[model samples]
Structures are given as C-alpha cells and as structure tokens.
Target: MKKIVLTSFALVGLLISTSCGNNKKEAEKVEVEKEQVTPTETESTEKETSESSTIVAIAAANENFTTLVAAVKAADLVETLNSAGPFTVFAPLNDAFGKLPEGTLDGLLKPESKETLTSILTYHVVSGEFKAADVVKAINDNNGSFVITTVQGGNLTASLDGDSVILTDSKGNKSKVVLTDVDASNGVIHAIDTVVMP
Candidate 1:
C-alpha cells in the first residue's frame, strides 16, 4: 500500500515537472516568433501605407484619364478594377480617346452600350502584375514578341518597335505605349496612344 502511495506521488511530481518544462519551451518559442515577425510586419505595413493608391484612385487623380474614368464609371467596372487584382492596365489617355471616330465615344457612353464598354475596358487589363522590365524581357525572350492575355480573355500582341512597346489588339489595330510603369497598389498602368479594340 505504501509503495502504491509513493508511486502515485512520484508520478504526480514527474507530471508537474514535465508540464512546467513544456510551458517554458512554448513561451520561449512564442517570444522568438514574435521577435522575428514584428519587424517584417511593421515594414510591410509601412510600405503598403505609403503606396496606398490603387489603380482607380491613381487614374481618378490624373486629368489625362478623365474620359477613361468616365467610361469606367459608366460601365460600373470601377469597383472591379479597384479590387486587389495586381492587374496590369494599358490605360488610354484623353488624347487616345479623342482619336476615336467622331461620335463613337458618345455612342459608347450610352447605358445600352455598357456591355461593349466593359469589354473594351477589361481588355486593357491583364490579370497579373507585370513591370516594364519583365515585359521587356518577355518580349525579347519570345523572339521580340510577347502575347499578353487580358482579363477580358482576349490577347494583345506586345512587340518592341525601336525602343517603344507596341500593343496590337485582336482586331489587328495597333496602339503605341507612351508612358510605362505607372505604379498602383492594385496594379500598374501603361499609357497607350490609342484605345485598342477587343
């Protein structure tokens, strides 16, 4: 009977020691993890805060994209484009829209024409982030021509003309990229000289 009692005490003491040891180990591990993660989290938060402007926000701030902004609003795609897409947008400047045939823009802005406008807008956006260097590399590596798939499920042929990037739409219409790599939180924008068709 005494042996059983002593054994039970011994077991209880052993369990207490083991539990204490495990708790100590967990505490140390948590501290180390917190230390490692804190700096990275802080840096990431600061960077995101600094670059908080999204593609829609950036476009809205600029006067050059006034027509494009209006079209986006008319199409009700402003929210979609403003999402966390990491999209690559080939933005058309006001001059580019002005190059459209007379009364074309007016017709497209009609409520009944929203579907076509949405298609045209989404055609300008690729689903992923692609910087200027990556684009150039892709073009150079692919025999000086790279095909970029747009969010609209159509493809745009990207090729270099001297030092400029030319985007040819599925309709075989050509648009010259004027400004490259306008960074946004959700994506990047490359201004084109013409509003390419789907």
Candidate 2:
C-alpha cells in the first residue's frame, strides 16, 4: 500500500510539471508574436498620417515653403486653407517671396495690412482643386490661354510658356509654375516662382 501511494504522488508531480512547461512555452510564443506585429502597426499609422495631411500641413512639412507658411499664418488663413472642399493653391517658395521689392513682405505682415495681405493671399487660391493636367487641358481648350477666377474675386490668366504653366496676375505680373500636383487631403498645390498679387 505504501509503495502504491508513493507511486501515485510521483505521477501527479510529473503531470503538473509537464502542464506548467506547456503553459510557459505558449506564453513565450504569444510574446514573440506581439513583438513582430508592433513595427507593422507603427508603419501603417505613419503612412496614414502622411496620406491624410491637409495642404497647410503638407506645406509646413516642407523646408522650401518656410516663408509661405509664415505668410499664411500672418494672413490668418490657416484654418480656411486647411478646410475641406478641394481648393487649388498656387504656392510660392521662399525664393519667390525674396524676389519681392525691399520691405514688401514686411509691410504686408503688419497688423494694419491684414486686409491687403488677405486679398493677395486669396488671389493665389481657387475654389476647386485643379491639377496640373486639368490646368493644361483648360489652357488647350481655351486656345492657348485659360482665365481662372481667384477666390479674392480677381482673374488670373494661365498660359503655356514652352511646356511650363505661366500665371498672369491682376496687376499684370507674371509667375511660372515650377512644380505641380502636390496632393493634399483638402486640396492640391502648384508651386510658383513668383507671388501673384491681386
């Protein structure tokens, strides 16, 4: 009887040890799977952020548009440009702002010049999203020149100048679109070489 009891206890101990070992192995496998999945989830999140960024966010992320970003903020148009409805923005680079006559940019940023600044900034924007291909098509359909109405209630003439899209502002100043079709969640931006004033 004593021998039988000892054998039974030993068997029970062996079974418990095996069960614990299996549970530990399962726990380790679950941890490994979680580790592998983390990076993929992070990558997906980053891609979504990039794809959903608005026009202002896209411009803010680029280094070339520092001046443009500043001007947008100064003009109090950050929210308007960030909203939905698919606007077409003619963005000017820092170099374009630099080409302005001395004190022009500084003067525009002044508090009293807010209305004037807003008008000038709005002149670069259109109501609907027009891609480069669409603009080209419009120009061709219009017999080499297409007139686009600005959000500020002025007209800009778009023409092709040797494969480049040129914009003639209300003041008769001209700007060349250097880069086109910068996609944004709210709109698209075409970078111009000069600021087209209203």
Candidate 3:
C-alpha cells in the first residue's frame, strides 16, 4: 500500500512538473512574441513620423524628386532646409531639371559650382510655411501679386495664373505649382514643373 501511495505521489509530482514546465515555456514564448510585436509597432510609427518630418525627407520619398534630392545634397542645403522655421520649398521634379538648357544641370552639379547651385536651390525656398491657400490669399491681399523673399536673398513673385499659383524667378522665368501643400514638419513643399533660377 505504501509503495503504491509513493508511486502515485511520484506520478502526480511528475505530471505537475511536466505541466509546469510546459506552462513556463508557453509564458516565455508569449513574452518573446510580445517583445517582437512591440518593436514592430514602434518602428512603424517612427517611420511614418520621420517620412513627413522635413522637406528633404518628403522630396527623398517621392520618385519624381530624385534629381531635386540629389541637387539638395550637392548644394549642401539639406541641413539648412531640414532645420526649422517653416520654410516653403518650391521643389522641382526630375522632368523640370531635364527642361534646363543642355549642360546646365551638369555644370551646376560640379564641385566648382557649389555656390551657384546653392543660390539656385535656396532661391526656391522661402522662409515661411505658406500653404496654397495662404499664398493665394497673400496674392489677393497684395493686389493680384505677392513678392516673397527667398533664402537666397532674391525675390520671387507670386501671382495667380487662373486658379493656379505661378512663381516668377528673378530672371523672369515662371514655374507653376504643379502640386501644393505637401506638409512637412519643418515646412511645406510645392512641387514645380520648372526649376526656377536665382
């Protein structure tokens, strides 16, 4: 009887030990799963936040602005525009750069033309976050035209070309805002079809 009781107790203990071990493994697996899931969630949120944070980031994300992104990096204006204070960037698309005179883009990308390229790029950036509506309103308020000072120390004239906003560079070349109100944490980007000169 004692032997039987001892054996039974041993079996019960074994069963309990096995069951406890399985539960521990399951708990550990759940913890690992939780750890894996948490970082994924956080990473997604961070990626979304970073994607819309700056003009550079926004331009880099768009396939059409590859040339512009390269130009920004070339001009060393990435950090300036990516800094702060609500800049309004009139970003030119790759097709717009193609519209430049032959060898113009190539010359500008050269190391010797850094100052000139920086001036041209900075000419596209105004020191404030002006959305399309605000820009139009300012145009209207200024009697059908508004002159905005750019980061390059040049002035860009904003006028209404029908329902669209047209930006005129100092050299009399005009670039129409193809897309507007690309809100970035640092400012706004208005994609232009033409690369405005300083």
Candidate 4:
C-alpha cells in the first residue's frame, strides 16, 4: 500500500512539473513576439517621417518665370528640385522674362528648344545651401568677386558692391540679386530682375 501511495505521489509531481514548464514556454514565446513587433513599428514610423519631409514641387511667384517652370518639367529635373536638398535658386520674376525678345518664351517652349531651355534653367541652380550672408562672405574672400559653377556647366560671376550683389552671366549680361535669401524647405530662392543666360 505504501509503495502504491509513493508511486501515485511521484506521478502527480511529474504531471505538475510538465504543466508548469509548458506554461513558461508559452509566456516566453509571447514576449519574443512582442519584441519583434515593437522594432518593426518603430522602423516604419521613421521611414514615413523621412519621406514626408521631402519637397515634391515648386510654384513660381510670377508669370515671367513660366518659362522656367516648363523647362524644369521638360528636363525631368523637377524631381531634383523637389528633393531634400537645401538648394539656392536665383529666381527671375515675370518682368525679368520680358527682357527676352518677344516670342522668345514661346520658341523655347517648343520641343526642338528643349535642350537649350534645360541648360538655361539649370544655369540658375547651384548645388548646396547658401544664404545672402554666405554669398557676401564668398565674394569678400575673393576680393569682391567670386565665380559660381552652375549645374548646366556654365560659370556665373558674383560681385558684391557695398550692400548690393551683382550676377554676371557668361553672355556678358548682368542681373542684380535684387532680393536675397528667400528660404525654402528644399532650398533658397533669390529674386532677380533680369534673367541670366548660360
């Protein structure tokens, strides 16, 4: 009888131990699932924030720059402009476009003039971020003159005269940086009264 009782007690203890081990294993699995889910959620949220911060478009503040807008779209450089770069754009207003001969804007919009138009528009862009103060400093460092290389493979001369900045193109045409440092999410825009050709 004692042997029977002893054997029954051993069986009960083994069953209890097995049941407790199973419960612990289930709890550990739940914890591991939670840990994996948390990191995935964090990574997805970070990606969304980074994408949302990018600039996707540009709006010209005047009718004169209509030519610029069309060229940007035609050159497929709209994506570059919409990127996350803090670019500095020398934006010429509508009156500046009028400086071009009549029908010039229309001609440039044609398919044949696409390449030329693209070059002209890219001549206005410079890589990296530069404010008015930085421009002035650059000019001062170069003895009131500095050369700026455009994305269009042209050189533009920047000159500082007291409080005014002058931009001269390769074609010997001059445009004053009438308004300096208009800040943008992707870059800076400087308003000029005249268009600079590449």
The positional error of residue 181 in candidate 1, measured at the CA in angstroms, is: 1.0
Q: What lDDT tens digits, residue by residue, belong to model 2 across residues 1-198?
A: 999999999999999999999999999999999999999999999766845598889999999999989889999999898777589999999999999999999999988998999999999999999999999999999999999999999999999999999999988999999999998987899999999988
lDDT of 4 by residue, 1-198 (tens): 999999999999999999999999999999999999999999999766644443223344445457666667777777788777767788777778878999997888788888888888889888888899999999999988999998788999999766899999998999988877766677777878888998
- lDDT of the candidates, in the order given: 0.93, 0.93, 0.91, 0.80
Question: Which is better, 2 or 3, measured by lDDT?
Answer: 2
Q: List where candidate 1 sits over 4 angstroms from the true fold.
A: 1-52
What is the model-wide C-alpha lDDT for candidate 1? 0.93
**Whole-model lDDT, candidate 2?**
0.93
Candidate 2: worst-modelled 10 consecutive residues by lDDT: 46-55
**lDDT (Cα, tens digit) per residue for candidate 1, span 154-180:** 999999999999999998999999998
| Lowest summed lDDT window (length 10), candidate 1 | 46-55
Question: Candidate 1: RMSD over Cα atoms?
Answer: 7.3
